[model samples]
Target chain A: EPEVTQTPSHQVTQMGQEVILRCVPISNHLYFYWYRQILGQKVEFLVSFYNNEISEKSEIFDDQFSVERPDGSNFTLKIRSTKLEDSAMYFCASTSTGGDYGYTFGSGTRLTVV
Target chain B: KDQVFQPSTVASSEGAVVEIFCNHSVSNAYNFFWYLHFPGCAPRLLVKGSKPSQQGRYNMTYERFSSSLLILQVREADAAVYYCACGAAGNKLTFGGGTRVLVKP
Candidate 1:
């Protein structure tokens, strides 16, 4: 089956640097999202993208965070300034819609900030 | 506060079948969800929203499918640990810390 794909499964960056996590959602899906999970925590929603704009975003996604569909196939999350707390597993997901229908998630991109 | 409480915290770094047990005190029930997560990996959606005791036996037409209550029959591929979760009336899904299941060789 066709699944959502992400690039650079693991990444390590120095604190205060920038990091970009990328994802390619299922082709037919219409909604996109980003979530994070600390090593010992449940996954938390970061932001939801729709109609080429962000429809929803969590508090964790503050001034340092930004997302864009730079092109038709790539959805990206950019962290302007990485912090120790920013270290976590970032996952990308897509769904036809979010109400009743389900979502498909990518294997995830591990972001490590030193 | 309103949140997703996943219990049974961390387990072995390798193969595990996490139970991902959860419950809710919400006066009005809405939806349920389950997701699997690997160490240093992203959380994957394994099961979607379900009503209390409403998830039917997992009957699969494909031989590779499972048919038990919440992943009824288990397999090695199903060995990624499991979690049980519930979504509130809103789209928020509160996850159980999850149960870790290991498959011995």
Candidate 2:
């Protein structure tokens, strides 16, 4: 079965550095999302992308955060400046355009900021 | 505020009986979900969107237990971590940390 795939399973970056987390969504899906889970915290929605544009975003997705689907299949989330609070597991998920289906999520990329 | 919860936390049961897992949420979210994960692996789709499916004794129920996945006549292979999520309007999902179940021989 097709599944969302994320790159750089783990990353370590210093405060104030930039980090790009990449994901390749299932080929046929249209809705894409980025979520993060701080250690011991619930998953929080960061942003959603469709048609090469962001559809919605959470307050947690502030000025320092951005998402781009540079290619037909590659979706990316970039953190312009990392902070200690930015340490978390970032997950990418995709759903069919119809909106009735569940999301398929990648294993995730663990981002660690020091 | 939105929250999903599974109180059992962990379970160890025998391989031939039914195990009913539970999920609760402060969210009156219309959509609920269940996903299963094997050790060292990512979560796999099991059931979603208030539609519960029954496959060889795996039954998902929405009306009761807030949302639940019932595994009948469990097997060793059924041991895994289970998670539940709830949301309204099919928007963002609020997931519970997860419940771990162990089916013994």
Candidate 3:
């Protein structure tokens, strides 16, 4: 089956640094999302992207965070200034329909802000 | 506030069935989804419930504010963290704390 692909399976960065996580959603999928799971915690929605703009975002998605579908195929989440609390496994997901159809998820980028 | 609740862990023997129960506090959310995740792997979609019930080896029962995931004849490979999610609309999902299943052979 086709899959969502994410780069940098693991990353360690200093607190206060900028980080950009990259993802390539399924070719035919339309909705793109970024979610984060803090270790041993529930998965939290960060942002949803559709038609090259953000559709909705959680409160956790603040000024420090932004998402872009730069090239129609690659979706990215950029954290302008990371903090220690930013450490988590960031998952990229896509769906042809909406959540009722479930989503295809990427292996995830584990970001560890030190 | 919307909250999804699930047990922390469940242990079962191989060939036994495992049922993970989930409940949510979002009264307006009717869409339920189940996902399975192995450590360091992507979360995989196991079932989707747009309505009340789904049929398959991995069955799902979705009520307006609660859902259950039934894994039939589970094997060792079925050991993983299972997450229940709900959304008021159709886009963003709010997930439960996840139930970790342990299958013994």
- List the candidate 3 regions with Cα displacement exceeding 4 Å: B52-56
Which of the two candidates, 1 or 2, achieves a greater TM-score against the reference?
Answer: 2
Error of 3 at A82 (Å): 0.9
**Best first by TM-score, ranked:** 3, 2, 1
Q: Which stretches of candidate 1 lie over 4 Å from their true place?
A: B9-20, B25-29, B38-44, B51-77, B88-92, B102-105
DockQ of each: 0.35, 0.46, 0.74
Q: Report the lDDT tens digits of candidate 2 across residue range B8-83.
A: 4555566565454556654556667777866435567777766666655667777643777777767778877777
The sequence of per-residue lDDT tens digits that candidate 1 reaches over residues B4-101 is: 44345333323333233455543344555555656645556554544333333332111111111244434555556555545433353444556665
Chain B TM-score of predicted candidate 1 relative to the true chain B: 0.52
Candidate 2 vs candidate 3: which has greater TM-score? 3
Better of 1 and 3 by lDDT: 3
The candidate with the higher DockQ, 1 or 2, is 2
Model 2 C-alpha lDDT per residue in residues A17-107, reported as the tens digit of each score = 9999999999989889998889767668899888888888988999999999987989999999999999999999998852346678899
Per-candidate TM-score, chain A: 0.97, 0.97, 0.98
Stretches of candidate 2 off by over 4 Å are B16-28, B88-90
Let me know the TM-score candidate 2 reaches against the reference structure: 0.87
**Whole-model lDDT per candidate:** 0.66, 0.78, 0.90
For model 1, residues A1-114, the per-residue Cα lDDT tens digits are 778898889999999999999999988887898988888676677988888989888889999999999988899999999999999989888877663545677988889899
